[model samples]
Structure formats: structure tokens, C-alpha cells
Target chain A: MIHWPVPEPEIPAGTHPALAAVARAAVAAFRDARGRFDRTQLAEKVDMGADGTPTTRLDQLVDTAVAETVDAHRVNLISEEIGVIDNGSAVTLVVDPVDGTSNAVAGVPFSAFAGVVAVDGEAVESLTTWLDTGRSWHAKAGETLPYRTTGRRELDGAAVSLLRPHPKSEDAWLRVSRRAGRVRVLSSSCLEAALVAEGSLDAFADPGSDTHRIMDIAAAAVLLPAAGGALIDAYGRPVEIDPDLSRRWSGIAAATPDLAEELAEEINRPSS
Target chain B: MIHWPVPEPEIPAGTHPALAAVARAAVAAFRDARGRFDRTQLAEKVDMGADGTPTTRLDQLVDTAVAETVDAHRVNLISEEIGVIDNGSAVTLVVDPVDGTSNAVAGVPFSAFAGVVAVDGEAVESLTTWLDTGRSWHAKAGETLPYRTTGRRELDGAAVSLLRPHPKSEDAWLRVSRRAGRVRVLSSSCLEAALVAEGSLDAFADPGSDTHRIMDIAAAAVLLPAAGGALIDAYGRPVEIDPDLSRRWSGIAAATPDLAEELAEEINRPSS
Candidate 1:
């Protein structure tokens, strides 16, 4: 065993009970929907969305269902399909009713993550969410109680899970894939990247065209950095989580700053 | 939901208790050792094998432990680290103590498979084994029941999982990854191929080098074909499994014969 020294970082304290509650409810909703969706008997009861994404009648129903239930708590909603719903409050709630629409439609068991990012104009804090498996990973802005794994701490030893391989960047794919101790392309990029924040994985890379929205990585943005990990744009720059819900960005997330830097440097290396 | 009209094919039988028994014991030992190895407080407690592969003291202990347990059943053993051990019978047991050694050492969850292709010198009879999570998949020759999947019935919309991007293969990766409704690379070729057999995934491909051995795909050979899938080499040729455990090969497994043909043609495309 090639042992490496790792500093166990702490989870922050801003993870509110309200955020955790919403995250749990979101996960349960997704899990229940997933089981029903996978049953051979009920494969086609859903409808298609405007973006050409699969949105089942169940999906819309679940979206509205989550919206209504969370609205009861009077938290402002920033969602994937639907944009933001402001209730004249400082704390904004961001949600992806179903993050991995494609996978969820196809019966892959991943996660439905919901995050609450308390923002006062430009400053942000905290994220908490649960997955379909009833397992939750959360971290406050500066606390010490969340995901941590024991292993060699090289970004190379990390499982860099991607949604799809880089098409225009074959050389980049080879570099990342070779360095990644193991590469997994789990369909759900949202959950895949969140695993990095939870320390279940060392890093997560998207590096696709800038089509991945903030809603896709918003909860992850809040969750990862709070856990001592960082999410950076494809250019290896920090991703600014503006109030804009539709702002799309391509990037990577690392469990540690050192890993984020290492991966960024390697992935950003000039393709020979 | 792009539903295609098709009748389900006859499911093949893959019931082989003795082979299944050996596989089960080996997988269980590896998994238990793996779990302990993951939590081992000391780093050097693990053993690195001569093949540049990882073997924990737990792995060695488990391999021996599993072999001795199988010895009680009076079957010969052929494993990765240790060469073939005779048991005074014509029967030989082919085993890969751990299929994805790199993945295992890195704590990546993938299957550790075993195959017992009962052969009388040159004639083959049956095979069976367990996957990463301990799910049993197997089949016997001339048996009608092979582990099969329902998803592969819809060829047009079926999901195909690959181990890595096609390596030097023409449009094989592109055609498959884009054509399939969903594509994933879970890193474990054996388990991914096994899942194809079990119908969890519609198809699987590992276009890597010939590092994948007969032992790696032996259990899959029994499981996939019995489950209505086809396994072939990277060149898309038939993968012949010899009774001797010394051989290794590279290949792909598809849920349907049509898919296998499609993949082969695509990979052989001149521009690809």
C-alpha cells in the first residue's frame, strides 16, 4: 500500500436543518420515482421537456410536488427546469428537481441533490443534500464532519468520474484517464462530482462544452468548497456562482486544493 | 420512448453449482479482504504482487484461504498470483483471485470474478460466478437458461457501457456511445460485461489492450451468452476460452447478436 499523508478537513457549520430536510425530501422523491420508472410496466408515462430532455409526467409532477412542498417553508427556489422563484428573502434555495434527467429516465440509481445556498447579494454559504440511496453528504462553510476517504492522495489515484469523454480533446482525455487511478463515467455528472465533495471520490471533471448549468453544479459548488475542495472552470480558474441560474460552465472539482491544482495543471497541459 | 416491436428471445440456462461455489467463495474472500484492506490502519500491511499488481496481506491470506476452502471440494485451482494447483482429478478450476487489481487497491468498487469451465481435457461443460456486490450469474453449456436482460430487447434505445474510449478502434466508441440512449464507463470490464449478461446494461466494450485475460471474461463468457449476450475479442472475433488458465485476451460483450455485428462493422470502418 502506497501510503500518503492527508489532512482530514472539517465540514462547515452553516448547513441548516432546513437545507438537510429539503435534501432528504428531494432524495426520497427521486428514489421513489426511480423505482417506479424502472418497472417494465411503467416506462412510458412521462413527457418530453422543451430542451429535448426526458421529463416524464412524473418528472413534472415531482418538480411541482417538490416546489409546492418546499414553498410551504417559504424558501426561494432556484431550479433546473424552472428558473428562480424569489420570495423577497436573503437566503436562496437552489434545486435540481431531478439532476440526472437522462439517467433517471433510464433507471440508473444515482442521486437527487437539493442545496440551499445562503447568499446576501454576492457572498455565499453552506450546502446539504441527500442521494437516492438514503445516504446524505453535507458540509457547512467551516465545520469538520463529512466525507473523507483513506487512500493515496494523488489526483491520479482519484476516480475522476465524467458524464462523457471529451470529444474535441482526445489528448486531454488520455492524460486525465491515465492519471486517474480509475476512470468511471457514471451517467449522473451532478452526483458524480458531488462524490468528490463528500470524499467518496477524490475529484470530478466535466470539461464538456459550457452547457452544464449552475443548477447542475450549484449544490455541488456549495457542498464541495465547504468541504475543503474547490470547483474550477475548464481554464482552471475559480467558478463564480453568480445569482444567474442559467449560467453554464465546464470545470473540475477536487477534494483538496493540491489535487485541484495538480489535475488542472495536467489536464491543462498543451496537447502534444 | 422509441419502443421497437420485438419478441423477447428464449432465455438460456446457466446453472452450474460447483463453479458457482468456487466463484462465490473467492469473491467473498476478496470482498472481505478488500473491505478490511480499505480500513487497515497500517499502510504496509498490504502486499504488492510481482505482477506490479496489489495484493494485501489480506489478499494473499484471502486467496490462500479461498483456495484451501475450494480444496475441500476437491477441485483443481488456477489463480492469478499462484499457478495451477492440481487436486488429483482431470477437472481444473480457472480463477482470477481479483480481476481488477488496480481498482481494488484504489478502493474502487468493481467485481472480483471466478469461472470454472469444467472440461475433460478439451471438452467444455459449464461455468458460473459472483459479481462485485455478490450477485451470482452463471450458465452451463447446452443449457437454455443464461443470465439475460430485458433492456437489450430494444436495440435502438438500449444503453451500452464501455470500459474506456475505443483504443485505436475505428468509430466503434463514437458509434456506440452516441447511438446508445445512455453510455457509461464503470472501469470494471468484468462486472460491466457481467451486468450486460444480467441485463442491467444492454451492452459493454473494453477496447483496451489484451490485458483482459481468459480468466477475466471466463465467468462473463458463461454469464453473458447464457443471458442472451455475445462476447468477442477487440477485433470482434470469437473469443475461444481454453481450459488452461495461463491465457488472457481482450474483448467486448453485447446484449444482442445484432449489436455485436454493428459494433464490429463500425470498428472496422475505414475512416474510423
Candidate 2:
């Protein structure tokens, strides 16, 4: 019975009208599907996604809603189930219709609908809506940001969220967990990054798995930077946001660039 | 915008009236504190808990409210902050006023207020109220259960939640994560166990840590078993629910006894 403040969408004023329209449409579509998200229906495998993950019925439905909505705009669409849709526009909208599909299917209440708008391979705007709660975080490339990170410099007693490690990265996961005071695996990249942006978490790391696509991290890429944090690849390089749906990378989003670099070193350091 | 069915407390008619009163008081106290749970106040270390962890301001406040309310009843109390309150009554109430204190402080929205009533060293009634949302799950030893687990028997493709491994148990964590189809570290033991009872998760494991006390797992012990699932120690033995705040045990709650036993073996298996 903890009464949390009801969060409202914080849309930046400088956002493109078309982008705002598309984001609103995506949210509406997700809201519709969320109302009917049944456990049995959610577990039904519909098809294989472009990323080689199996698509559940809920995934296919939400993807279609977001795809059709974004297709109305004069921008290219990069998504998971449908891959790349060439709209012949300068802007590319990277959309993860539903991030953390497993949590949504299982009613864990931590999934989100995320979309990021980029121009010429550079992200300009981003929006993420928590599907369970209507709260949202939106950011524009150069506008004054609404949130900021904690700027905690030390790893001791730091709280971090990590992706469950792939077998090859098990040792690295152990190393990082041993260094930090607390480790969490929330299974939603976008939401975890959002938590970092809002200073609820110190960092979110995906050690060595190339499981993250542009659609998954693009929104976070905009959010973390705008909030004075940084998201980078495992080698401590800035992540590129291209419209290529097949590409994958390992990355970490931290409250500060220094922390991001430190985490990269810890994650990439050879195990003793 | 997901239309979750409003969760009402499923209190069995056989539940002790005083126990129910204490549970309600705990929920009220939590709700009051949750209204103003700012990060700064939440992180203020006020005192050392009886369990040896540092207590936050929020923890002390909520613990005080619950303890005061429970003390009004004719029963002994065993809690995290205060070791034991001997009321000269045979029935003892074990309570974790706020489980997942870190998550609560960080606004992770996955914490819970958990309690169990033990009569003559036997857990007879349990209750867990999700702190963020008002959803609650309650169970009595002999009454019909409110929810049931998925009964998913296989380890592969099953969604399981584990506590982020302590450094000493890193290998066991790797083994358990590799065996499951998906792994999550929600960091809230009671709420995670509630998820298992409600079928959102297949299992929840604590590996080999002595972090879990009776207050944390006592509610789950009753709810899981009544829901046709089982919670057992790391060695696959039934977890004894004595009202001892000082004792600790590692445990797992799964949809079936077979799944629990399987997880125990996987965690205890010799490393290659």
C-alpha cells in the first residue's frame, strides 16, 4: 500500500510533431493490447522474430500496432518482428513494441513500450512508456533534461542491474558482482536504463552478449545521455544507432561516463 | 494501461482475528510511510537491525508501527529490527515489516510487507502485501488456497528468479541460470515468492546464502505449499519455520516438489 506519485508523461516541447504523434499512437496501441494480455494467449508462440527469438501472440499483436502506427509517419521504422521498413525518410524510428516480453506475459509488471527517433543515424528524440503503470520518460537531443543520475563514483555499495550472463561471460559476471555491493537482473534493458537515468540504479550492464539490438537500446541511448549519464559498448566505445535490425552489441549504461568506463573494465577484465 | 484485476486480500475465515488485525495494521503503517519515501530519507542509516544489516529511517519507522500494532495482541513477535518480543503466548508472529528494503529505497516498486503466524513452532497463517501496489495474497494452512503455480515441471524454458548470488555462491548461480530458460534477480524474496504462487514465475531460489530469515520466507512457506508448490532448503529438506529471528537458511520455492528438488541438485552439483 505504498502510495507512489502517479507519473505523467514528460514530453519535451521541441520534439517533432510527427514523432510525437507516432509515440502517442504507439502508447495507445500498447494500452489496448495490455488490457487483453491473457496468460494463455501470451504464451502462444506465433512466429520467429527477426532477431531469432520466438514471438509470442502478445508480441505479434503489439508489434503490428506499433508498426502500423509508425508507418503513418514519414520516417523509416526499425523494429524486432517486422525488421526494417523503408519509408524513404531522413528520420528512422527504432521501436521495441514490447521490451521484457517474458515479464509482461508472466504478469511481472515491469515491461515497457519504447521508441526512439534518430536522424541520419543520430538519435534526436526518445520515449519509453511503462506498460504496467502509465508513467513515461521522454527526452529530446538538446532540450533541458528532466532527470539526472546520482553521480556516485565508487563501486562499493553501488547498485547495478546486469543482464543474466551468457555462458562465455560467466566469469566476467562473477567479477563484476564481486566488485559491486548489489547486483540485480531485471531482464528489461530499456527500463533498467531508465532506472539509471532517474538515479534509481547506478548502472545497467550486458557483459558479453550481443543480444541488444538498436531498437532495444536506442531509447536508452537518448535517455542516459540527456540525463548526464552515458551508454557504451563493452570496449567503452559509444554505441551506434543505425537502422540495421540484424546487428547486435554488448553495452552498459551508467550514471556517469567515468562509472561507465569503470564498469566496462570490470566486465571485460580477465578472470583470475 | 494493463487492466490488472484489483487484488483483494484473500483472508481465510479460519485465520485468527488478532493475526488479521496485525496484518491490516502492518499494511496501514506501510502505506503511510510509502507516501513520503524520498530517496534521501530512505538512505539515512538510523540503526543496526537485529539481523546485522543497517536499518534505514524508513525501516525503523515502519518496523515501529508494525511492532507496536502486533504487540497489542497476545502473541510473541520475532522481527528483523527487533530480535524477539516475548509476550508469554504460544502463538508467535514472524514479520518482515519491509522486505526488499533496497528496492523500496530506490523506487524499484517490487518490495513487500510480509508476515506469518506460527502456533507452537508451526506456521499456520501467512500474508504478503505488495508495498508499491495494494495487491495482497494471504493463506492459512488448512483453508483452500487463493492461487496456484503453473505446475511447469521442466527446467528448460522455465522462468525462474534467483537472488543475485553472493560471491561465495557464484558457481551455483551460474549453474542454476544455465539450466533455466530465463533468469531474473528481482531482489525481493517475499514478492518473488508471491510471483511463484500466482504463476507469474516458475521458481525462486536463494542458492546458498544465509540471508533469508524466517520473517522473509515465512509467508512464502505457507502460500507456496498451500498453492500446491513447495519451498525447501538448499539440501532439499523442508525448511523449519521456527520463530527464531537469529537463524537463517537458503531456500527455493517452486511450482512442484519435483522442481524444487531438481533445483536443489543443480545448485549443489559438483562444478566441472
Candidate 3:
């Protein structure tokens, strides 16, 4: 409903049209591959990762094809399957060849997304696409990005849904439903987190939320922050991009930093 | 996804093709009107009701137009604005001209729908639809109904989209993100709730829920239950159909009974 005007900014002057074309082609290829496969077919194509996460042959195939096309762009890459591959450049292209693996595997139309975050070392600019539905959103230094937040957007009291319903899932839903917003549940943490960034949602929390591998949050790291959002780990640390996603971090709480901190305190607070 | 098979039952011997055609035409006309008018335009067209609920001239116009066409069918009418006008018949027809009035007036695409639930005044059957996007879902006694649920065939722990975000709006997003298969705020409580029965969503809940009248759930009453789903009041009571939809109910929770109850309990429990 908020038709905020979008502002454009100048980018590094270079012909990245080829990269863009390759990106489009990769997206088309992925969608085509998926269009041919259903949930049962997807399950057959997936394998368990070393991190106990599910990875599909399609995931690997798509990532490889995209990497092959974008490799010549000379941008350093940080991907989900393969770790960081440096191209001797200061700018890193953080990519998630696919975000909603489970939805894809389940044949849910909500799946299919590819994200690109241009990172200048610590600084990042995020671009995300909901490939299945083709809803694209991005935010860089120059544009007044698609996702922005209004802090202090509190619970008006309603039901809630959580990814890894905490030990206090029951209590959490109850507390929020009464005062904040009501809870509901959905899969695809990345998409949900993006909703939080877009101000369409108030928060996204997960306990035992080890599902997010490097590829998932790589895009989110750039997207959330640029959109006035923050992400926190379960132990209450700032959820950073684990370049070597071989190890699992605690969990995630993505929203405004203040609210994220408050929620962390509330969830971790001693039960009265 | 639980494929609740609901093979089409026998359409009564004298089901009129003309009647069905007229209903479909009315639905198309209403959709066109709503499409051309954005949210601001819709707000101007509506008249506020005494119970703090708002009604639109379009709503009445659509209802009357549909009813007038179906008048010769010798069926009792239970509708939104006009309540019930009994010509004294064993069979009843429930109609909702527009379900998501708020979203319709807000320029959100989460509105637009027409449904019919025909019953013998006892058990219900036949849930036919023309939904927000002009897509239709028809369910009868014997048909392979498409829907999904975790474990049991219900809307529990499923992606939930609510019209009003509980606790704070953020928590609604969080709850759906964490618990349900996915989280969506589609804006139309009626369509969203109907999707629960159709298995498009795990469930639909509205604690601060309103904007639904009898006609809203009439078609759903037949389809959801026929598809093995249920829609209940806040107190977990069956929604009664008055000959006239003079009084508005509190809100609706449509899902598998188990999922609906679990969510409702969590939502209504006293917060510490």
C-alpha cells in the first residue's frame, strides 16, 4: 500500500549486460528444470549435505551452470554449496542459486528464487527475486530499496508462527496473539525474512534454526540491513555471514535491531 | 500435501446450465468493477455499518444482481448485506458478494470471490467458486480435493495468513514464518480462510477479524466441510446462517478442526 517513490543511483560504469543476461538465462534454466519436475521428482534429486541440510542435484546443477556463466565477470563469489571462490577482486558477488529448497522439493509454487548481493568487503548491496512468482526486489547504495522498516511496530496481539518453534512455542504464540500480531506458520525462512524487510511482516524468528546455510543468509545479509532490518543468532549474537557455512550458528531473529534484541531478551528471559 | 479426494458428486437431475452461467457472469462483472476501481475508489463507494463494519454500494449491487438472476431457482437465500429472504424451500443458497472489503478498498489484490454452498438443510455439499484471480475451485462429495497438512489432514502448523496481525503485526509474520509451512498476508480473510479448506493454506485466522458477513462463509460452509474442513467462530461454535445477515460475527478460523482449535487456544490463552 505504501507507494514510496524509488530513487535511482549511479553504478560502476561497466558493461554488465552480459552478466545480467546470464543471470536471466540461469533463472530461465532453473525454472525450466523445475517446471519439468514435481515434488516427488525433486525429492529423488536431493541429497543430505555435510551440515545435515538437504541439497538437491538440481541445486548443484543450477549453481554450477550460473557460476560458469558469471565466472568471467571477474567478481569473487560466495555460494551455498561451494564456499567462497575469489576472483582477485575486492567486490564479492554473494549468491544463493536457490533459496527455498524444501518448497521446490515439495512442488510448492512458492519456491524458485535467485539472489545477488554485491559486497564491497563489509558493505553489501542486495538483489533478490522470487523466481516462481517473479517478484523482484533489490537495494543498493543508490536506490531507495524495496525493503525498509518502521521500528517500534509492536504486537497488536494475534496468533503467530515460527520456523523452529522454540521450547516455548506455545507461550510465544499465546503472548504474541494477545498483544502483538497473531501467529501463523509458513516454510521458506528466506522469503519470510524478506517479508519482514518489506514491512509486510513484523518479525521472523527461528530456534534450532540451523536450516539457513551460507547461501540463504548471504543474500539476506545484504537485503535485510539495506532495508532497515537486522538479524541475530540464537545465542543472541549478530548473525553474520558464515563464509564457511560448514559450521552451524545458533539461530536467527530478523527484524529491527531494537525489536530483535527485545524479543531475544523475552524468549531467553527466565520463566516467571 | 493431503489429496483429500472429493470426486464430483451427482449434480441434481435438473441442475440448470443457465443458472450456473448467470452466476458465473455476475462474478465476472463484479471482478471487472473491482479491478477498475483501486482501494481509494472502493473506500468512497462503501457505506459504514452501525457495528463499525463498512459496506460498499458495490457489495449490495453485486449481491442483488446475483440474487435476481438466481431468483427463479426456488432456493432459500442466506447472504451478507440482505441477510436471508425465505421463499420457503428445503434447499438453501449462501452467497457473499465480496469477501475482502478492507483489502478491496486498500488496492490490495487479495479480494474478489463468489461462492455457492447448497445443502438439504442438514449436511452440506457442493462448494463452487470464482476466487480473487478468476480461478475457480469446485468440490463435491466425490472428488480428489487438493490440500496439504502436516501429519493429520488439517490446517494445523500450516502456513497461515491473517487479515489482522496478532500481538504485533511482526509476530504474525514470525509465527507463520516459524510454525506454518509458509507465511502469507494475502489481505482477504474470506479467500484466505477458504484456501484453508481448499488446502491452499494450512489455515486462516483472524483475531481482530471482522468484515465477514453470512454470505462470506455461505459457499465455504458447503465446500470446506465437504472437503473435510471446518470454519468456526471465536468460541469454536458453528457459524449460523440467518435468513438476514443483520449481525456480523466476531471473526473466523477456518482449518481442520484440530489445527483451528490448537491455534485458537494458543491465540486466546491469557498472556503473562
Candidate 4:
């Protein structure tokens, strides 16, 4: 048993009702899964997800609860496991119901529920809740967030968090890691991006892994800029609120545009 | 501000009262520091630690609090920043007041307060509190703990948490990382070790950087064994409760002796 109970997210007032409901549902489902399942059982692969990854039992439970919650709100949802739930509503919720499913099932305690509210294919608001502790980061597009970025402009001495390196991206991963003042692989993109928005981390990047599907980063695209940070793809592709689960990006969330570009440059640099 | 409040630790009732008081003091001081200082101010190098590492302001603050608490308890203390406080008692508290000082000061939320009650040179009891969330793991040396290890015996197909690779230890780090099914660098030693003790991770290791001072790993010496796990030095040095802050170990905490040995072998292997 994970023993520790998941706390309720301290969601702020005025959050979109649908987004808040989905976050609560995700958290409740996650807590229930932890309570009922052992680590191996929670991690057991129950089905193949739409994003070409195996869905663990924990992910299945949380994603199902989120899908139902999104339905109750009469909103469309673009999420990793379910792919797309179209309700013909212009308001769509892009969510990673359990963003760090591996961490969640393993009891590593870095998982999150991340969601973005998009209308007319444009993200207008986002919420990321660290499931274990219920601490949350909420932001609206074009609105000044109470939290702020470090406003750091360079990678020379930046604190960077990254996804674990895949074989194909090993060179790029090492390149950026070698240049950064500090490097961490927390294995949770949404939580790391929340860290960036709150000025805890200078940046969080995929380091050319191209591992981020739309739901993995749609929230960061809205939240980063609201906190005076930048979100860009390392390969110069535009990040957008798209319903296609097939598209991917090497998403980079940074304290500033200059630092994001610098990180992209470093990731693309040839090894000596 | 790292606006989220730190909660009180959920320590078990039978824990040594001195350990409980000291944990409370560390948490209180850490919360106070977070309230009073900005990131830059908290991260400022306030003094040279007895362990030869520069003591961050946050470390100094927590260490002082821990020290004062130990004095009030009339116990000796062996710690990172303050070194040995020999009060002529047979009982000594080995502590890392802020295990991940960088994470704490930067608001990354991976820091912890880890301590061991040592009697005459052996760790008899331990407690590790995740300061950000107040989740704690407590154990006594020869007693059975409510938590248990995964009982994994091999590194292949295992989940491993590791310290960030140093330039000198990069080869060793990659060797284990490639073989493990998962890799993480959460940047908090005691929390990682606690995870190992509770079976969340198959192993937590330093690879071969030899970076752990006695206080960095003393808690695991008691907690791991109590939880049916193993704690060993990668280089085969006996991990003892020592007052010598200068002694370093490439600490390996794993689910079982076999996995610890396998991790040690992999870490010491020459790169191909």
C-alpha cells in the first residue's frame, strides 16, 4: 500500500468548472487505485493506449474516471489513453489523466493530473495538480499568473529537468545535461513544467526525445506564457492545441524565450 | 514564495521521542526559512560546512534547528553542516537536516529531513520525513517494519533511482541506467532510500561517485534492513554510523542483498 493518502487539490476559485471537476475526479480515482491495488497490480498492463503505449491498471482507472467526468461537463476531451472523446462542444479538455503513470504506480510520488481547456483549437486555461500532495498550479492564457518564472535567459547556469533519455536521443540529452548547472530526471513532464512556471526550475525539456504528445504539453503551452515563461519544440515545430494524438514534440518549457532557444540550440549541437 | 505549507510528519507513535522532537524542529525551521527567504537568499552559501561542502542558507538554518533540538535532548549529533556535536552521550543522532538542499531552496519539493538514532556506533532506529509533503518512513534496526521490500534480486527489469552522474562516474551511471527498466534522478538521497526501503524502487544508488557522507546514508543502514532491504557501499566498504563527516561512500540501497551486489558489480564494471 502507498499508505499516504492523496490530499485534495487546492484549486483556486474561478477555475473552469469542467477543468476543476476533471482534476478532482482524477485525484479521487488515483487515490482509490492506490488504496485497492499493490504496486505490481497497479502497474499491470491492462490495455494498449491510443498513444501507442501500454496503459497500466492505475492509468486505466484514472482515465476512465476522467473520461466520465469530462462527459458530465459536456466537453470534448483529447487525452493520451482515450485518444479523443468528441461531444460536439467547442470546449475541449486536453488532459493527461495520470501524467506520470509509471511514477504513480511505482509509488514514486511525482505523478500529476494535467488538463488544458481549449476552445476553437486554442488553449485558454490549464491546471496541473501534483497528485500525491494535491499542490496545484493553475493559469489562464493571456492573464498574469500570481506565480512567475525565474526569467532566466541562458542555459549556462540553469537548473534543467528532463525526461529520461531514449537511445536515439542520448547524444542530445548528454549535450544539454553537460552544459546545465544542474540536471534532474524527475520523470514527470507536467509536474516539471509546473516547477518551471513557479520559478522552481529554470526549464524542463525532452532534449530532442520527441516524446510529448499533445496532452503531455498542451497545458504547459498555456501555463508557461502566463507565468512569463516560454514553451517551444526543440525542432522548431509549433506547439498547438491539437486533437490529434499522433503528433508529438520535443517540448521545452523554460523561464524565458532566450533560454528555451538556447536549450534547443544546445540539444541540437553536435557531439565533439 | 513557495506558498504551499509544509504539513506535520505522520511519525509512528513508538518512535524515539528525541528523534520526533528533532524532526519537528527541522520541519519548523525549514518552514520558517521558506517563509523568510527568496530562492536566491535561501540558496546563498552562508558558511562552509564541516563536511567540506558549502552550506546553503537553508541548510544552515535547518542544521542549526536540528542541533539545538539535539542539545535539548542531551544527545550527541553527527550531521552534514554542523558536523559532530559531542555532548558525551552514548546516543548520537545522525542527520541530514535538508537532504536535498538545492531542491529545497529552489522550491523543487524533493527535500527531506533524515535522521538515525545511533548507540555507541550502530544505527538503531531511523526516520525520514519528506519535508514538502510530511510523509515519513520510520524503522528500528532489528525489528520488523510494517513496510517491506519488493524482494527483487536482480538489476535487469528493475526500477532504479540514482544520483545525477558526475563526470568521473558517468560511465558507471550509464551502465546501470541502460540495464534497468526505469531510471530516475529525483535529487534527494534520503527520500530515494526511503522509497527503496518501502519497495517503491528496486534500488537507489550513487553508481560510483562516492558522494555520500555518513549522514547521507546512515538512516538507510537501519531502515533498509528493518524493511527487508539491504544497504551497502558499492566499493565494498562497510557502511557504519560514524562521526567522521569526511568519510564518503557510494551508497547502494536495494530490495535485497543480491540486487545490491548486482548494482555494485554493474557500477564498478569498465565501460565497453
Q: By lDDT, who's the top model here? A: 4
Tens-digit lDDT track for model 4 on B1-272? Answer: 78778888888899999999999999999999999989999999989999998999999999999999999999999999999999999999999999988899999999999999988888899999999988898998789988898899989989999998789899998889889999999889999999998888999999999999988888888889998989999999999877677899999999999999999999989888
lDDT by residue (tens digit), candidate 4, A89-162: 99999999999888998889999999999998989999999998888889998899988999999898789999
DockQ of each: 0.31, 0.66, 0.15, 0.84
Candidate with better lDDT, 3 vs 4: 4
Single out the weakest 10-residue window by summed lDDT for candidate 2 chain A. Answer: A1-10
C-alpha local distance difference test of each model: 0.57, 0.78, 0.52, 0.92
Task: Kindly list the per-residue Cα lDDT of model 1 for residues B161-221, writing each as its tens digit.
Answer: 7766544532456666656777787666666776666556677766444556666666666
The residue-by-residue lDDT of candidate 3 on A160-229, one tens digit each, is 2355344445454344344544343445556666666665456666543455565565555656767787
lDDT for B17 in candidate 1 is 44
Q: Chain A TM-score for each candidate, in the given order?
A: 0.77, 0.90, 0.76, 0.98
Would you list the rank order by DockQ, best first?
A: 4, 2, 1, 3
Candidate 1: RMSD over Cα atoms? 8.2
**True contacts recovered per prediction:** 0.37, 0.76, 0.08, 0.76
> Per lDDT, what order, best first?
4, 2, 1, 3
After superposition, candidate 4 runs with Cα above 4 Å error: none
Error of 2 at A236 (Å): 4.2
Q: Per-residue lDDT tens digits of candidate 2, residues A1-272?
A: 11122233345566666566665665565555556655877768999987777898888887787677667776788888877888888888888988988887777778887888888878888888776665677887776475688787666678889988788788787778888788999988999998888888899888877778877788888899899998888865557776556678787889898888888888778878
Better of 1 and 4 by TM-score: 4
